[model samples]
Target: MADPILVFDLDDTLYLERNFALSGYQVVGAWMQARYGVTDFAQRCTKRFETGAYTGIFNHVLRDLGLMDSPDLITRLVELYRNHPPNITLEPDALRFLSLPRYKGKRGLITDGPPRTQANKIAALGIKDQLDFVVRTGEWGAGFSKPHPRAFGYLEQAFQAHPEQMVYVADNAAKDFVTPNARGWGTVQIVRPLGIYKTPPADRAHAPAATITSLDDLTRCLTQF
Candidate 1:
C-alpha cells in the first residue's frame, strides 16, 4: 500500500494548547493592568482556568476584582486574547513523530479556530514548512469546522488521495472524528496528558478508529489503517 497521507490537528495534538491559553492570558492580563490598573489579572485568569472555568473566564476575573463585567470589556479582552502573539512549542513526542523517516513529506495540518489565532499558532510553532499544507477551517467559516467534511474534503482533493490512503490525528473526539470516520478516512485520537477532551465519545460514529495516549504510539496505531 502507498504511504498514507498523515494529517494532524494543531492545538493539543501538536502542542499543549494550555500553554497557548496561558500565553494569551498573560497578554490579556498585561493589557488589563496597563489599561485598568488591575495588577495580577493574568495570574487570576490562570487560576480560574486551572479551576475549570472554561467559559466567560475574563468575566469571572473581572467580577472577582469588583469590576463590571460589561459586554464591551469582555469583547475587548477576548479580541486581545485571540490576536496576541502566542508563545508555544511543539510537544517533544509530536516533534519526534513528525521527524520520523517513514512519514517525511506526507504531513499536513488541519485546525479549527479563528484564522488569526490559528495562524499565529502556526507561525509561533514554525511548523509551516514542516508539512505539505495546512487547512484553517475558520477561513472557510465556522460552519466548515471539524465534523463538517469540508476541510477534510479539501485535504482529499489536495492530496488526490482515496479515503483509505489518508489518516487524521486529532485530540477532540466530540467533533474531530465524525466526518473523517464517515468519509472513510482513518482517524486516530491522541490523548495528551493535558488535552482538554477527556471523556470518550458516546457513540461509535464519533469515536476514532484508534486511540493513543501519546504520539509515540502513533505509528503502531497507523498500522491498523
Candidate 2:
C-alpha cells in the first residue's frame, strides 16, 4: 500500500492534555489572584482537576473560596483560560515521530477546541512548520467537532486521497474513531500513559483498528492495515 496520509489529533495524542489544563489553571489562578486577592485559586483548581473533577471545576473552586459561581464570572474565567498563551510542549515520542524522514510532507492535524485555544496550543508546540495542514474544528463551528466528519472530510479534500489512504491517530476512543471508521479511514488510538480517556471502547464500533502506547510505535501499527 502507498504511504498513508497521516493525520493526528492534537490534545492527548500529541501532548498530555493535563499539561494544558494545568497551564490554563495557572493562567486563571493568576488572574483571580490579581483581581480578587485569592492567592490559592490556582492550587485549589489544580487539586480539584487532579481529583477527577472534569466538569465545573471553576464553580467548585469558587465555592471553596466562598465566592459565588455566577454565570458572568464563570464565563470570564473560561475565556481567560482558553485565550491565554499556554505553556506546553510536544510529547517526546511525538516530537521524534514528527521528525522522522519517511513521514515528511505526509503529516496533518485535526483538532477540536475553542479556535483561540487550539491555535495557542499549536503555536506553543511549535509544530506548524512540521505539518502539511491543520484542521481546527472550532473554525467551522462547535457542531463540527470529532465524530462529526466535517474536519475529516476537509482533510480528504485537502489531500485528494481516498478514505482508505488516510489514517487518524487520536486519543479519545469515545468520539475519535466512529466517523473515521465508517468513512473507511484507518484509525489508531494512541493511549498515552497520562492520557485522559483510558477506558476500553464500549463497543467495537468505537474501537480503533490498532492501539499503541506512543507515537514511537505508530509506524509499526500502520503496517498492519
Candidate 3:
C-alpha cells in the first residue's frame, strides 16, 4: 500500500474544542471588564460550563446582558476570542497517532472557520510543523466550507492523492463526513469525551467508515480499506 493521504479536522479532533472555547471565554471576560467594568463574567462562564451549557456562551452572557447588544461590540468580542493567544495543547492521542508508524501517510488539515481563528488554533496546538498542507474553508469563502467538497478536493490535489487514497478524519457528523463520503474518499470520525459534538446520532446516511474514540485507533481502521 502507498502512503495514504489523511486530512484532519482541527477544532475537536486534533485537540479539545472546549479548551479553545474556555480560552475564548476568558478573552470575552476581559473584554467585558475593559468595556463595561463588569466582573464575575468568568465565574459565570464556569458555572454555565459546569452545567454543560457550553454553546452560545457569548449570546447568553454577553448579548442577553444588554451590555453588548450592539453589532460592533459583538464583532469586537469575536475579534477578541479569535485573536486571543490560547493555552491549547494537543490531545495526547492525537500526538501519538501522528507518530504511529502505521499511519505512514501524507498528513494535512482542513478546517472551516475564520482563517485567523483556525490559524490561532493551529499555532496553539503547535502542529504547524506536523501538517503537510492546510486549507481553511473560510479563507476561500463560505462557498468552500465543509460538506461542499471543494476543500476536500483541494487537499487531495495538494497531497497528490487520488480520491481513493484520501481520508478525512473529523468530529462533526452533520457536515464533516458528507463530502468525503459523497466523493468516494474514506471518512473517519473521532469522538472523544471532551468533544463539543456528542453522539453522531448514527444517521447511516452520513456514517463514517470507522467511528473511533481515539486517534490511535486509526491505524486499525485504515486496514479495512
lDDT against the true structure, per candidate, is 0.90, 0.91, 0.81
lDDT of model number 3: 0.81
> Under the 3 Å rule for N, CA and C atoms, how many clashes does model 2 have?
0
Clashes of each: 0, 0, 0
In angstroms, the error of model 3 at 101 is 5.3
lDDT of 3 by residue, 50-146 (tens): 6788666666677556655567776777788788888798899999987777556788998888898888888877888778998888998768887
Better of 1 and 2 by lDDT: 2
The weakest ten consecutive residues by lDDT in model 2 span 98-107
| Model 2, span 35-142: residue lDDT tens | 999999989988888888778999999998899999999999999999999999999999999889876438899999899999999999999999889999999976
Span of 10 residues, lowest total lDDT, candidate 3: 61-70
Give lDDT tens digits, candidate 1, residues 1-225: 667789999989999989999999999988998999988999999998898667889988899999999999999999999999899999999889877877643878899999999999999998898899899999987588878888889989998888888999999998899899999999999988888777788799999999888899988788888
Stretches > 4 Å off in candidate 2: none
- Sort by lDDT, top down from the best: 2, 1, 3
Each prediction's TM-score against the native?
Answer: 0.96, 0.97, 0.90
Off by over 4 Å in 1: none
- Please say which candidate is ahead in lDDT: 2 or 3: 2
